[model samples]
Target: MGGGEPGLGSAEVVQQPEQADAGSPAAGRLGLEPLPYVVGEDGAKQPVPGALSIFLRSGTAAAMCLDSLAAAQPGAPPFLRIPKEKLLADIQLQGAISDFHPIKDAIRAADCDALAVRPNLDDAYGDGNNYEVACSRAAAEAWQAVEEWRRAAAAEAEAAASAAAAQAALPKSKRRRAPQPWVDQGTEAEMEAVAGPPPRPPALLVLERPLRDLVASRQRHQRAQQQQQQPPQDQGKPASTQPQQQQQQQQQQQQQRAPRLVDVDASDLWSSAQSECRPFKDPNYDTRRARREAGAQAVPRLAEKGVQV
Candidate 1:
């Protein structure tokens, strides 16, 4: 009778139904799925493999790629809806929405034309495959960046280790330690001692109090007397012209203070060339010609006749 009623059923029957497979979409959609598991050696259920265990493995790389793509997108309340047609197309594609890890040359054949366009958050939030496609492109870029960084870090570490090994293989005499510049470790007191007590601060000289007071009083008295004497003369003159008169007086005083240039008779310049100036003589005409003539006269010419014995 309970089963016959329109919707009513036995409480036991309502409560219990054949459970769906844990990994199946139906189970996930209905919230009936247990946490993912695998059978262990003992036939006991074990938790599914972690990201780190599966990330590098070729077998699980596509799954990891999908997971990253999903994670890159906003989670569903308004569910992430990919159209059935687009889903079928993605399945037909070689690498689907995203290329798998250590992406092979074969995977490049898959039409990833969507990746060519920059991913936009607005498009990702729109209806249909836009969300998945944008997320896949973005996640792929992020994965590539991480992979490149990992490789670079690994290479640097390997190079450093090899360098260290090579250095260790060298003989002690051949090995050079990295140079360290000298750093001052002297304490303030030690430094002061080395510098000989800062030149005794030049022995500050303090003026006696009585002398300071006397000097200050004299200055004040002089200022008072000057001020008293200056006003009567100032009353006779216009205030504006006083500055001009003062400037003129200063100019005149400056002229008077200038050093005088005294005029005197200067002696004629003493020069060897001027003192020895006489009528110019040509040595060739005077000494050389005379010597040549005398030498010519002194030399006897040989006659046509034979010389006397």
Candidate 2:
């Protein structure tokens, strides 16, 4: 016979025993006495030999045993020991060959070297009998992918949480208070009273021209007083009190005409000389100069101008 249909090979078919004469050795081995044989299906007297008889029993038993074994192996194809009777009944009633194919393929694909059957079934089939061996492999790979994704996501979340916790744990630095507007409005001496002594004044305020000039003038006066005590080298005539008094009056008049000093604190001055002062220009300078040269005593002078000084 040509190698029967793809799955129904010669090796798979159960062999029947031959009918023989009574008392023959084959009949004795079979534990049956072969008499006159009728070939028709209804009237046939079939004699099965011992080897074939054993094979048939073992084959049917194998199918039943597979079901129990398949249960033990979770990843196995789901069609191990499906009841042949039920399979036949389903085929007869439903005539669904597509359902039968997957079950058969699952069983055939199972590794014979495996220690136990693997009864992995597809979710598409409500009954475990419709097993999909390939689908089980695919599902396992998909599950692994899902597990890897979950692990990565969990690690990322842990790292993010740790970073947040670290940030929370750090001590916060104290913020400096903003400088008050009133603090900017005063002299160094006044601000010193408010702020208390240690820092001194800002450099700009401490080095102002007016305060610096006062310091220099005090030093010059001290030097002059020290020089006066030294003896003169040449003999000189004694000055007359009458001329000295007249000269003293002239000096007083000059002193009275000099510009009066206005007090400006260190805080109001700029740091550099260029920034501190600009040359003054009088708007009425030509007229004032002409009037003064003409010996005019009263030239209708402008009123005093008030400045921040």
Candidate 3:
């Protein structure tokens, strides 16, 4: 390269005297060759002072420009460092004193616009796709909670229906509840009824028992009234009854004279009746029951004079 004009893709290089000797090659060289550098996380090697650099007017002049920027924005880093693996990773950095606009304007004024290339923000954080995924996850969780509530409600309804069905399946006698009288009905009228109408009979026997007892009692009353109204007749035998009485007395004496027993055995009757009557014997009888006791050994015949018992 010539002395007055700079070489393409070369920065001002500070040479070491030990790197060159007088007789060897590159002995009188004075120009700068761009060094290899990686810039802005592109993962590709670039020439120093190239388009990817932050200050590329001239390495000699770039130092002066950096000093001016540091004085203007003292909170910024003193040096510009290019990342090697990811683009615009600095998107997460806070409170940056020097953003791209001022740096770009400064590079343009210095006639070195190639240095201030702006990186894309979309590429910095994966185009905001991670944010979309988080929103989708939140929406899915809400829908899942709603679905769970619906299922629980449905299960409760089904259980209630099953319980109702089981109750209905029981026998009517067990499951039936007592009837509630209507409020609008005549409660006072029913209470005041001295003889309420009979309930509808489910069967005839429910009505028949009281009817039979009433008929029997009425007949007995009529018979008692008739007996009370009639006067007792004289005790002297009537002419028509005298002969019948004589004949009946004569026949009874004849039967007594030759009484023929059929099913009556005195010995068997005595033993069986004594055993059966044993329970009726009072323990206190020997001491105190003699006066009050009826004649147990001698049974008084219950037949009236002319009637069989």
lDDT by residue (tens digit), candidate 3, 1-309: 001111233343233345334432234332222122222243333222322223222332243244443343534332333321111222223123223222332223333212222211122223221000001222223334433544444465576578668879998877745334345356557765854544653332222234555455556555545644765343586888877777866775685576443322233235654565423444442231122322223345588342212
Task: Report the Cα lDDT for residue 168, model 2.
Answer: 67
Point out where model 2 deviates above 4 Å.
1-103, 110-139, 155-240, 247-309
Which ranges in model 1 have alpha carbons more than 4 Å from their true place?
A: 1-139, 179-189, 198-309
Candidate 1 lDDT by residue in tens digits, 208-256: 3455554565565455445436533445788899998788668756855
RMSD to native, candidate 1: 39.6
Q: Rank the candidates by lDDT, best first.
A: 1, 2, 3
lDDT of 2 by residue, 1-309 (tens): 000012221221122344233343333343332221112234332211100000112233354355543344534332332334444453355453333332443334433322122232231212223122222333234334433544444465576567667766766553233233343355656855885444543332222235565565556545545554656433454556557756765775685576635333333344565565644554542221121222223235478453342
lDDT of 2: 0.36
lDDT of each: 0.37, 0.36, 0.35
Error in Å for residue 151 of model 3? 1.2
Candidates 2 and 3 compared by TM-score, better number? 2
Worst 10 residues of 2 by lDDT: 47-56
Cα displacement (angstroms), candidate 2, residue 16, comes to 59
